[model samples]
Target: MAGDSVRDDELAWLDATEQAELVRGGELTPSELAEAAIERIERTNGALNAVVTPLFEKAVAQAASAQLPAGPFRGVPMLLKDMVCHSAGDPLHGGMRVLRDHGWTEPEDSHLAARFRAAGFVFCGKTNMPELATSVTTEPLAHGATRNPWDPSRSPGGSSGGSAAAVAAGMTPVAHGNDMAGSIRVPASCCGLVGLKPTRARTSLGPGHGEYWGPVAHEHVLTRSVRDSAAVLDTIRGMAPGDPYTAPPPSRPYREEIGLDPGALRVGLRTAVPGAAGQPHQDCVAAVDEAARLLESLGHHVEPSAAAVLDSPAILEGFSAVFGTIVAWEVDRWSQRIGRRIDLGELEPMNARTAEVGRSAPATQWLSGLHTWQQWAREAAALWEQELDVLVTPTLATPPWQLGELAPTALAPAELAAAVGEKIAFTVPFNITGQPAISLPLHRNPDGLPIGVQFVAAYGREDVLIRLAAQLEQAAPWSMARPPVSA
Candidate 1:
């Protein structure tokens, strides 16, 4: 098929699976797909500022190369978030001005990047992210801000905001994203995509470090379809050599889980922000209510319930302790790698303050914080063990807010923490428990912005999530819901 026959919007909306099928069937060469994506990025990225580093020439060459792997997603174009998962010879700034100023490029591909390449994804570019992936918004000093495609005034959510924005705006069918404190899911929620944070260690963090930000961080992708997410996971999910730990391997390929019936499930619904004084926005609450009803109609047992331990304020204290220390360690690690100390002034104010807190925290306090989290996780797991198969909540407390509203530069440390706490209230608990969670775009507010609902499964139970998410996807299809600023 000739490229001129297909509308650019049609090609932009095709998921990776569909794009791969066309390439495999010889209807379109990989070069056509790559070039089409590049054109879309060139046309759309200026408004969204999603792709920070375009590799169009390299992508076109790779797509046309005979060496391109013939894996499931062969010939598909995708964007990598410029954090955690690095691509060889590509600029890996981690959204920091210091790294960009130093002109640092990753010498080798991360294990995850290799898996993506093996699966036949052409890396068109790296997406923008918050500095050091510290803030929940993608307004890094290095890359400016990535505007939401849904509404330019609002945020796309971060540190995976650029990835989410790119996918939503149709620059790419899918993009890599990592979640520490709702980075992937929040962005997915904001951008109207599927964002899955697989169980801890499901995807390796290797040849560099074992775990990122303790056990709370996990890497995956934001895609327009549940099956795309499942297919991508099947390709990248595994342990690397000398890894710290690994999630339980799926009984079969995760792709097989799609369309499989998720028999009658006992789902608990929660709309209140745990440990916070107020409930989420009315729109968010309504989203959960609608999702619960939809689940009930689909033969799942949905009830108004939540784990009691979620209300404990102590959870925040423990999370803060671990989070702060990790930031400090990250600063130190980068300093050693760059062969110079990273002055506090070089970091964003929020991270600089967090580093200070982390540096001052005694080892005993850090350990105590870990112990506290472990204790709470054990307690929280009881809800699943006794009654719930899945827990549903609003992915974020509200729909996407204005871009600068949550900027660390505009708020004091405590103010920023409180604001971030509200946004991540429902998503972070599962991160601590090392369970699988996914954000689905099930609702949209009056303003036409997406409001996502999160579903949590027991530890290492991504199969459960995939099945249910697929079922929900079918029940309320969202693939055709395009944003205002899109390809």
Candidate 2:
């Protein structure tokens, strides 16, 4: 049952946790599983171009030396997205050519990596991403665009697009992804997978800064099942030694949350435009309406509600200042290490533009943005306290776009932002507020592309969102749905 051919087809397609279980149960060995996954990557990665850098040799070596954790996911194979999170000895390109020929990882794993290993995941290698993961689509100058596994004609949503694409193409069951402004959820929406952004600090970000740009970026996973996402969260939840914010401990393991009855939650359903720059696509709106109706059928009280309107310019301006500063810092550190001048010349136009914007930003802009975000978070939290258990919106404002639609050369920073603004109308504010959110694959267009419905909860309320998502998963099973390429 476990062989090279099957690795390319069946084994590669199993969820990461299932592969680990197969290894733990003695149905297959970790070495065999690793080889099979390696084979699948060799066979399909060229077409999908999901994995930019290969680590099969190291993966096989690790498979031989490492012992599987006695957890639910014992010997599963997985990929780490390139932008954030690092493993010892793995080449980290950050999806940029300037960092192309570099190597050197810390002696210890990032908290995200450590937790994934604790969950029984073996890192086969790193996946692709946009340069610096600043863009919405996954086309980095360093690594060519990652195609959607479903059509190859459309994009797998950004930053985590390669990880999602890999999973969609059956190259791996699950992959590590980060979300600050929809990286994980966007790709999941594009590729038809379950993506969850746990509440800020639900998972640790350690061996670096105290927090990731004030919770705008959180690490998560993209998977095929809600249970898998829940299981990973259970393993990863908890603060490490240096977290700036620590979410309260879960009263029980999250695996139990998947099946627990989230009885009669007052769902705040709204298809209104986000305070962001643009409106969602028509199909995205219809998908939200359909999800609301389904929740009604499930006996949940679905009603319209709205939170305080955000100061759009202040939010963007503020977010940009902090975002640009992070980029500048990372670029400087890497440039010094690589012993080369990594000027804007080496970067894509968008990357260069963002760096320039950051450089030009006044210190006051960052301070003001921080204050604005804090004020908005407090105001939004109060509104949530009074009116809703969950806020429903389209995960993305538009369905997957054609492959080169958001190319760096083709679009300026403003144009790209505007283009992405229209599609991802609702994601960033949650990032700013540090709310827990999940993207459920609930609707499909006539062409069979999946659309995700996003459910967001108050800060530190991932348990509530997870429980609710589990209910929705059962009411409308998306597990059997496969992208066209896989089918």
lDDT (CA) for every model shown? 0.91, 0.79
Question: TM-scores of all models?
Answer: 0.98, 0.94
lDDT of 1 by residue, 1-487 (tens): 2266566679999899998988888888889999889999999999999999999889999999999999999999999999888999989999889999998999999999999999999999999999888878899888899999999999999889999999999999999999988899999999999999999899999868788787788989999999999999999999999789899899999999999999999999888888877789999999999998899999998888956778986689788778788889989999999999999999888888889989999988788888889899998888889989999989999889998998868799768867777778888888889889999999999999999999999988999999999999999999999999998
For each candidate, C-alpha RMSD in Å? 1.2, 2.3
Off by over 4 Å in 2: 1-8, 103-107, 276-279, 308-313
> What is candidate 2's CA lDDT for residue 66?
51
Candidate 2 C-alpha lDDT tens digits along 1-487: 2644344466755776677667766878777877777887888888888998788887787667657565667667889998567876667888878778555344567878888877767788889998888777888878799989878899999879999998877777888899988888899898888889988888888866567655587898899888788888888888888777788888888878888888898888766667644556888888999999999998899987765444355556656667776677667767886887688777887667777777777888777778878876777787678888898988887889888889887777778767765555578878888888888888888878888889998878878888888888899988776676652
TM-score (C-alpha, index-matched) for candidate 2: 0.94
